[model samples]
Target: MTSLILLSGWGCDARIWRPLAPHWPHGLEVKAPDWPGYAGRPSLADPTSLTDLADAMAEDLPADAVWVGWSLGGLLAGALLDHLPAPRALVLLGIGEHFVHPQGVSDTALADFQRALRRSPDIAREHFLRRQLAGEPDPTGSRRALRELLGTALPAPFATLDAGLEHLAHLDIHHCLSAASCPVQRIAGADDPLLAPEVIARADQRIENAGHCPMLSQPQRLATRLASVATAPDAKRPESTS
Candidate 1:
């Protein structure tokens, strides 16, 4: 059976994809695995790098699967394209090769949030979550509900969170996009404040009226899109301008 692996982003657990579980397409096996340090997993090893972190997550994923990733999860999936034995394709939601964007989340703003996370993880996490949904029509309500679904941004050993931030700050998958041997499909929330609308529109597909976290705002709609992604022929990868 073709496996459909759903990878969650930073500050989130496998349960973040729970809302879309019942709506997945029939026949394909679906699984959502927690990142190295989230959910109930213990702290990531010392000096955690993106390579090492993706390696750790590799164990839980299938060698050949249609991987659907959100935010940080999308980045992880991109990094692993070279590692998977038979990666079918990749569907990135609310993320791209580079996290820092001038029209999106500025480097300075993200740096400030990273520093705040180091000094006060809880407060910074809450603020970060709020910002994720700021583009939604109902930011207050979405934040309140999504806050519970995603759980805490910080698990044990705050360094893992720091390391995750480091990955976001530095790691760019510009190389991976061109090197990828498998098909790639990019999807994003129409109202995501974190990522520019132009970026999302450039994707192979896009969701409407959703914020950075589409699974929570429009789970059914997102699920339908994933179904289409699964059934469609291999999507063409965009040529790199670099």
Candidate 2:
């Protein structure tokens, strides 16, 4: 039987995937892996490189498993695909080769983000929800769900936040995707301002109208797509062919 591992983005806890769990297909064991230095969970110190983080996360995963990751998690998933045993398939949500603004942001924006992280988590959470839901059709409920999830975790440390920002700033996973042998499905929200269609066009499968947090914005749709990918015979193709 295939297993499904859900990886959440930065500043989020496993609760972000709660809505999509129940809808997963039968016979598939689904689990959400928590990131280090968040949710009051134990985390590594002085980690370097996204691949290192991927290795740490892989320690708890089955030898071969399907991984579904969003935002920053998607980048980690891509890195994991580079070194770990091949998964049956991979699903990337709300991100492409990079999660941060590729052209790079102005000092003002960077400072603002740093300030937001340092001064008030509530402020940071609110700003994050706004951006995450920027183009979604029904952002009202989604924002509420995000807030509820945020309420569950402690404020992330500045070190973790800084490391995550650095990772996003330097992230470039297109090569990783291009080298992945397993089938990859890219899911995005039609209104998502973060990842554009052209960015995710490289995916073998694409789904629209689901924002960065599709599990919350469109749980049923995400579950359906994930189930199909898991059961499909061609889900595990070689990187050269995929």
Candidate 3:
């Protein structure tokens, strides 16, 4: 049986995947590990490159696990394509080759948030979490659920936040996607203001009316979409669906 590795985005712990737990499609073992330094996990030793981060996350993963990553996690999955023991497939969510986007969060916007975070990690974490939920159909309920889920688990050290931001600033796998050894699938929330529609439409699958954290906003749809990726062929072919 193939296993699935679920990687979380920046400022989020593996706990963020809980909503999708009941929605995982059949026939796969799913594992979500706290990235180095987030959710109280220890930071990777001398992690000088994206490859280093990938290695640290891979230590416990099976050689053939399908990697499903969200936002910053998506970028990490791309970096691991060569370093990992060769995954069965890769699924990228709410992100593409780079975190900097035209229709999404810009460098200036992120820089401003980073500056605020440097001042107070707690304040920044909540602020960022709320900011990430843009385009949610029900702001009241979604915000409530998101806040409860994030309750007291964040405000992680600045160093851990910086580690992830470092990759967002420098990592670019657009040139490397062609060389990926496994099947690649991209999925994003259709209403995600953080992701450009055209950019996400390029994905193999997409969840409708959802935002960056589709797991929180549309768990069932996201789960079904991921099931599609898990069983997909190992190829670069892109599918346009909403």
- Model 3 — TM-score against the truth? 0.90
The reply for model 3, stretches above 4 Å from the true place, is 153-155, 232-242
Please write out the lDDT profile of model 2 over residues 132-176, one tens digit for every residue.
Answer: 776665788888887776673444666776677666656777778
Deviation in Å, model 3, residue 177 alpha carbon: 1.4
The candidates, ranked best first by lDDT, are 1, 3, 2
lDDT of 2: 0.69
Off by over 4 Å in 2: 101-112, 118-122, 152-155, 200-206, 233-242
Model-by-model lDDT, in order? 0.78, 0.69, 0.76
Please write out the lDDT profile of model 1 over residues 1-242, one tens digit for every residue. Answer: 45778988776778778888888877867888777767668656752565576667777767677888889888878877766654777888899887889899889998998999989989887787778888776887777777677665555357777777777787788788778887888888888888866787787777788889888888899988887767763677857866
For lDDT, the strongest prediction is: 1
Q: For all the candidates, what are their Cα RMSDs to the real structure?
A: 1.8, 3.3, 3.2
What's model 2's lDDT at 87?
Answer: 76
Find the 10 residues in a row with the least total lDDT in model 3: 233-242
For each candidate in turn, the TM-score is 0.92, 0.84, 0.90
Q: Number of the top candidate by TM-score?
A: 1
Instruction: Write one digit per residue (lDDT tens) for candidate 3, span 1-242.
Output: 56778988888888788898898766667888877877777776654466677667767556667788899888877877767776778788888888877567778877887788788788887777777786777766787887677776563567878767777767777755667767778888878777776787776776787888888889988877766656664546333232
Clashes of 2: 4
